[model samples]
Target: MQNALKELILQMADDALVLGHRNSEWTGIGPMLEEDLAFSSMAQDKIGHALALYTILHEHMGEPDPDKLGFMRKEEEYRCCQFVELPIGEYDFTLARHFLYDHAELIRYEMLVNCPFEPLAQMARKVRGELKYHVLHADTFLRELARGTEESKARMQAAIRYAWPYALGMFEITDADAQLAAAGAYAGEKERRSRWLSTVSSIINDAGLQVPEPDEAKAIYGGRKGYHSEYLKPLLDEMTEVVRLDPTAEW
Candidate 1:
């Protein structure tokens, strides 16, 4: 039970940490100044959330302190889904990924708000509150872009299609998922995926976009098992550079 819970927490924390850095990449380069500030703000929120979850692990699960657990892990030891590890490509693709991911995240935390694990449930309540803003930002961009010129609609559609499979990969079930669900620690990935699909499909259709057929979009899994694309190791190297430079420095 404890191991399953630990796995669940690690996966969530790793996902937040990696995606936070990816979002931070847009701090100065976003196409517009408002968007630039928005992504930067969201990036801070994500990293803060990661730190909170890592602290939970340290407090309850006997893991190392948040700093060590976050920066010292090898690429293969990080449990973030491969979807978040991919380079933030064009703006359309990034927005599409954000739309897909934040909705799923909101749903996952919503499910956990009343979970049996008091520590996690307490955190989930706080996370769900913050996630609402993320979903709103993603949804607004998706709709506005899809309703723009023909080229904008076409690009948004293409980006959504391209992101669909990888988005599904976000819910890849782990070995511990079943145990987590059975023990009331979590509701499991399948349930979250189901709710996410329904929730996002409605928004996508209303925005004049097509949600790709699930059968045709084969999820790009394996990340839950510590398997990742070539992108992750490089990302980790960059993220941990400061820590490596001066491990003894106090935060």
Candidate 2:
């Protein structure tokens, strides 16, 4: 039970941390001034979410401190999905990724609101509030851009298609999933993925965008198993550079 819970928490925390950093990259250079602040704000929220999850691991699961767990781990030790690690590409791609990823996150947290695990359930209830706005931001941008000029619609569609497979990978099942679900600690990834599809499909269709068929879209996998793209190592290096420079330094 402990191992299963740890696996689940670690994955969630890593996803938030990596994507938070990616989102932070857009802090000053968003396509527009409003979007610039919006991404920056969301980035802060994600990192805060990561820190909270890491704290749970430290307090309950015998893991290292949140800072060590976040920055001192070897690249392969991190469990974030590859989709989050992908470079924040063009605005369309970033927006598409955000739309797909946050929908899954929102649903996942909603499912966990009543988890048997008290610490996680408490955290989920709080985090979901923030996620509501993240999803709203993504939804609004997606709908408006998809309904905009021909080029905007085309770009949004292409970005969605490109991100589909990787997004599916976010729900890659693991041995720990069955244990967690049976224990009533989580609803499992399959269920969350189902809910996510139903929720996002309607929005995508409403935006005049084609929802990628799950059966036809091959889910990109491996990050959950600690196998990552070349992108992850460099990202890890840059993120941990400060910590490495002076391990004893206090934040």
Which candidate comes out best when scored by lDDT?
A: 2
- In candidate 2, what are the lDDT values of residues 1-251, reduced to their tens digit? 88998999999999999999999999889999999999999999999999999999999889999999999999899999999999998999999999999999999999999998999999999999999999999999999999999999999999999999999999988889999998989989999999999999999999999998896349998888898878899999999878798899896
Error of 2 at 173 (Å): 0.8
Q: RMSD in Å for candidate 2, one decimal?
A: 1.0
Supply candidate 1's per-residue lDDT for 169. 92
Per-residue lDDT, model 2, residue 191, is: 95
- lDDT by candidate, in order shown: 0.91, 0.94
Off by over 4 Å in 1: none
The TM-score, computed over Cα atoms with residue i paired to residue i, of candidate 1 is 0.97
Look at candidate 1 and give me any clashing residue pairs: none
TM-score of each: 0.97, 0.98
Q: For candidate 1, what is the lDDT?
A: 0.91
